[model samples]
Target: MVNLWTSSEHALSYLAIADAIPHRTEGEGVLLNQVPKTVRRILDLGTGNGRLLSLLKIDRPQAECIGLDFSPTMLAAAQEQFMGDDSVHVQVHDLDQPLPDLGQFDAVVSSFAIHHLAHERKRSLYAEIFACLAPGGVFCNLEHVASPTERLHQQFREAMGIGDRPDDPSNKLLDVETQLQWLRAIGFEDVDCYWKWLELALLIGRKPTV
Candidate 1:
């Protein structure tokens, strides 16, 4: 219930350790592989500091990218990340609310975000993501998911070297299976947990071309 993302300190702390998260790049690589190079547009939800969007632009240089986040600190950092680049735009938007009318996208992606939302909102957001995708488009979410048991969760904490530290109060972690089911019920095809490393997992789904 305590969303500290709005605080500058919380945002900075996350940015400082963002790259150090174990196996994160591997999940990111898997996400990149799911999206096609020919995608005309991309939407990055909760695009903190635009990290994922930057990676996406590596192979999708011509793609028009939009990164959305509500935190002022995050928005500034994202803006700085894409400065002098007209193709990438970072804007203010809260993931807890309905996504703005940004038209449709060929690829919708997120990383290490979305879990902060309440369970009901998470499901609704997945539905909204489904609505925003173009036919044949894909949704790739590299997320922090819940473990099946508390012991596994504790092991994950220890693996992350944070066993002694308190859990992030902001994380409302949900299991991957429920999310995959939501995607399938929302009419996505080929829905599955494409990649995973302990609590980290990549959930991928595609819209039908027809």
Candidate 2:
């Protein structure tokens, strides 16, 4: 259900199973390496449980980070995870809406989240991310993308241990190439799919320093 994320129990269950998703760390690590350690401000979109933001903060301790998500349960969990730490601020916002005015960020990141949006929204969000970045800033998305064929999709489902379950209705999976093209078209430089294994992928791009 689209509204399932609003449930604390559902959100916690996702967190419980989050770590068991195969090769996730590898994609996350690649994303980490792409973000500059000297980053001053960072924004995490659809920041479920603040896990990715927490990882970024480990390398950039002084960075001011914003974790934005619409889910009440996720927002609560993220806020609790960073409570009393002024450096990380968790905000409640829906990605289905345009990004709020949070000022510029040196890096904008997301993980397996954007695919929940429609393709048009995904493109619009990329443009918004580009506009929200400071010149030369980076965008890294560890994403769940569509497989080119049903057989590959089935294989991916098997690998993720979800062989029989029907596809999630919230998922509006797009292919890797189209997303890369969208990033470049939105004025992001150095756009590419950096790392991928089946449906899981690391899509990266950088804003030009113009």
- Number of the top-ranking candidate, with lDDT as the measure: 1
TM-score of 1: 0.99
Give the poorly placed runs of model 2, Cα more than 4 Å off: 1-3
TM-score of each: 0.99, 0.97
lDDT tens readout by residue for model 1, 1-210 = 778999999999999888999999899888989999999999999999999999999999999999999999999999999999999988899899999999999999999889999999999999999999999999999999999999999999998989999999999999999999999999999999999999999999999998
> Which pairs of residues have clashing backbones in candidate 1?
none
- Model 2: lDDT to the true structure: 0.92
Work out candidate 1's RMSD over C-alphas: 0.6
Candidate 1 Cα misplacement greater than 4 A, ranges: none
* lDDT tens per residue, model 2, 12-62: 878888999999999999999999999999999999989999999898999
Judge candidate 2 at residue 99 and give its lDDT.
96
> How large is the C-alpha RMSD of every model relative to the true structure?
0.6, 1.2
